[model samples]
Target: MYTPRTPRIVAARRLQRRKDRDQSGRFLAEGPQAVREALAAGVVLELFGTGSALDRYPELVAQAPEVSPVTDDALNALAETVHPQGLVAVCEQVDVPIGKALVKQPRLVAVVAEIRDPGNAGTVLRTADAAGADAVIFAGDAVDPYNGKCVRASAGSLFHVDVVRSPLTIIDLLQDSGLQVLATSGAGEDDVDSLLDGGLLDRPTAWLFGSEAHGLPEAMLAAADRRVRVPIYGAAESLNLAAAAAVCLYASARAQR
Candidate 1:
């Protein structure tokens, strides 16, 4: 069993930092769900689990070629959550280029533009996967999709979709692929439901979501085919990035299905 202070454990812990993750071209996937997904994605380099966790999930252990049993304390030190799920894995980064992702001719794509919050970014990725989005583009200065909190928030869906990081050029790339890029904005001129009712959502679409603090920038809004607002019938000022993305992506998913 690797001790918490062992060199391998210390090295894995460094993955929690963006610089370290970038330097190593690797990141940590903590908990059973995230680790399982990482393993299934065929990106896991090493799998570490507590003895109990290894016994509890024999299926995972059987599938993993490089498995190590660790003490509970060692597992806790490696985990990011308050309650560690006793399993974690070191995995390679899987994000591909925007052009490669576009080659799939995705029916639905989620474009996250400058979303700073890791949780929000992760939630959006998870929601996008659930909505059957073929790819997720992290455009502008968006947070790293491999950030530990983001990975945790994604609940394993991170491995289920193509995640790409690009600049504002992502918008042009998405549009050039024959997709109608719609920016979700509070001041949007078009209503989401109205567009859906009008059959606009049935087209190959990409939904642009902005940061939590400020919505989409003016340039982004202008670049989009149209700006859409998720109707606020409840009198709540506006939906958060995750909620807005869920509504928009699901609308497109249902429309296309």
Candidate 2:
């Protein structure tokens, strides 16, 4: 049983702090969903601090009763969120084995490339879980999968998803698998909604979304089996990465149903 430390942890108040995330390689897991998922993932809970409001998750706390309880004052700085969820855990990042990363035959996959934002990456993961997408592969230049903010943004879905990271060329893998490598383009041959419903995604498909500022690299755009765009009718310049992921993944969900 781990004994509780009284003095507070400094600089780690905000979950987004690089030191905090890097040190734990797990960051802070807060809220019911996040905490539940982390527990399911077999994350090593260094410490779990909670408030009376969250007595509802006793079963969850049972996973680690030695977990410390903290007042909002201590929890606030630890999480750095405006409203502390009353439950937070310092956990070790769950690592994925390379062999178990990919399924033998995945009909649908979410390929996240060059995605820098942790929140966006986390949300995409959540979307993948909800859509029952086969897997999530992080190509080169993606954000840390275990970023606290991302974990929080995912609302706990990361625990259920199969996330993989590989060095092979992403398009090469898809093409070799005979899967349609569709990329989300700001301006493309087909609109996103039309293609998703029209059958472009009917086969084994890999959906890739790029960085926000610059859509996708030219070479990658060229390699796409096809390109699809999400239409914007409102005054918004562009949809945020997480929102766009939800839209794209939901399209696959609709098709599957």
Candidate 3:
């Protein structure tokens, strides 16, 4: 078994940093679920686990293109979670160009902009996949989709959808896609029900979501074809970024189908 100080182990540990991840074009996915998904996606570059972990997940280990047996200490060094799962996989980055992501003529897309939280970003990605969105675009200043927390939060959905880390502005990209852009906001002209009732949601659409604290930028909101709000029937103040995204994406999903 490889020790924590092993050369390969040391190199894998560096992936914990975004700079290393970006430079290497790879990231770590921990636990069996992520390992399984990464394997299915054919993105796994190397799989590392304790002997017990490898034995427990015989199929995954067998399927991996490359495998390394590591000491518990090495596993600990690689994992980001408080309670480290026995397995971690180094997987190539799955993000694609904006044009390729939208090449399928996506009917439903999720545009994530300026969301700094990795967990929320991953949840939104997971929700978008669940809602059958064709693609997800991480626009200006959004959390990196490959961040370990985001990858974990996605619960393997990161491998299930087309992900785009765009260099162009959200407005420019949205305009080029020809999909109606709907910005989710507390202050908005249209509510989910109104859009549904009016058949506006039937069109190919992209839902734009912003940060939990600040919401969408003024410029993005103005650029959107419509600003939409999710109506709260009860006395709750508001939903968090993930919850709101789930609501909006599903609404569009239902309408388009």
- Model 3 lDDT tens row, 126-215: 999999998888988888898999999999999999999974266766667779999999989899999988888988899999998999
lDDT of 2 by residue, 76-144 (tens): 656646777667777666646434654356767888887888777888888888888877877777777
lDDT of 1 by residue, 1-257 (tens): 98899889889888889999989999999988887898899999989999999999999888886898888888998898899988999999999988888998999999898889999999999999999999998889889999999998999999999999899766687789999999988888998899989999999999999887888878889999999999999879888889989999999998998
Selected candidate, larger lDDT, 2 vs 3: 3
- lDDT, candidate 3, at 13: 93
lDDT value, residue 32 of candidate 2: 63
Report the number of the highest-lDDT candidate: 3
**Superposition TM-score, candidate 1 onto the true structure:** 0.97
State TM-scores per candidate: 0.97, 0.81, 0.98
* Per-residue lDDT value at 78 in model 1: 86
Cα RMSD to the true fold for all candidates: 1.0, 3.5, 1.0
Residue 152 C-alpha lDDT in model 3: 97
Ranking by TM-score: 3, 1, 2
